[model samples]
Target: MAAHTAIARPPLVPEIPLHLATEITPIWQATEAWLGEQGIEPPFWAFAWPGSQALARWVLDEPGLVAGKRVLDFAAGGGLAAIAAARAGAAMAEAAEIDPLAHAATRLNARLNGVTVVEAPGDVVGSPCRWDTILAGDVCYEAPMTNHILPWLRRLAAEGAAVILADPGRAYLPGAGLREVARYAVPVTRELEDREERVVTLFRVLP
Candidate 1:
């Protein structure tokens, strides 16, 4: 994991250090070669996406929101938001990821930032809500993935968990039941996204 990445801070959340790839193509190729398959999911864990960057910034700036609360960073790429939540005094911070490499990256990054983030590896979609607050960043990009997680997320929201989602205008984001709470213009590289920056919106998922 350390071989392909460098310890760098994300543009929006500079306080936390992450092991991130400098370019997309090389990392993608490397991931494919390492995994021995071309059909695997993109190495989303290697880059700090716009949504997670915004979430981390918001959590750090407004620590009171997560202070003493049980927080979860769902689909946590590099566990950026989880690190921020821990730094902001969350009672417990957890990061959930299906990808093994993402889990490793999260563990590595958490250690780099000197924070303890419990790893919730494998599929946690149908699990009972163990969190007081949940941060899902850039999760609604693909239709199938959006469909798979939305119902469970809505259920979590209905069960009184404050499920917060940060979106950078992904096509699969639902049209309703989101109350906007914050917005950020996150800087991004054109290699990953079409635009050089993305306006990420944070929403409270309403049940």
Candidate 2:
């Protein structure tokens, strides 16, 4: 890994530890430059983002929410939520990421945490619901990404899947058609989010 290694305990989700970058900016820049050289997207897998941390924490705490259910961690960077679901007694915990490097990172992190999460192929938008639960974290950071994913997620929710989104006050988050289930104050590296603490909200997509 290009990042300086450290045992990171994310805010609001301390039980699920992660091998995260000790210094955010250097590794972030290094990974970005390296990916650019290879003509790849940003290496978001190098860190345990705050929203993912909160979702993992919430799932671990409320094991009944996912116990014996099939779970899908969408855009699962580092597979934190997927690992938590597996550990929380989900029948199957799968992570789907478009970036190969991020997918590999998810597998590595899952192993470190003593769990197994299958990797799904290709972009999952428009795919029929194959799991009982869907978890999306910090996915609304960009308008294009949110626009592309929100409608599909809404459709899944309408189909009776438990679709949950963890957002850190993104500009594009929907104002309606969702209900807040929980919230957490997640501590994060300022270099990554320009703030030390982020208040993330976990919402259940309503049909």
The model with the greatest lDDT is 1
Q: How would you encode candidate 2's per-residue C-alpha lDDT over 153-181 as one tens digit per residue?
A: 99999999999999999899988998999
**Per-candidate TM-score against the hidden true structure:** 0.98, 0.92
Per residue, candidate 1 scores C-alpha lDDT tens digits across 1-207 of 688899999999998889999987788888999998997778999999999999999999999999999999999988999999999999999999999999999999988888999999999999999999999999999999999999999999999999999999999999999999999999998888988999999999998
Q: Give the TM-score of candidate 2.
A: 0.92
Query: Residue 186 of candidate 1: its Cα lDDT?
Result: 96
lDDT of 2 at 35: 71
Candidate 1: RMSD to truth: 0.8
The pairs that clash in candidate 1 are none
lDDT of each: 0.94, 0.85
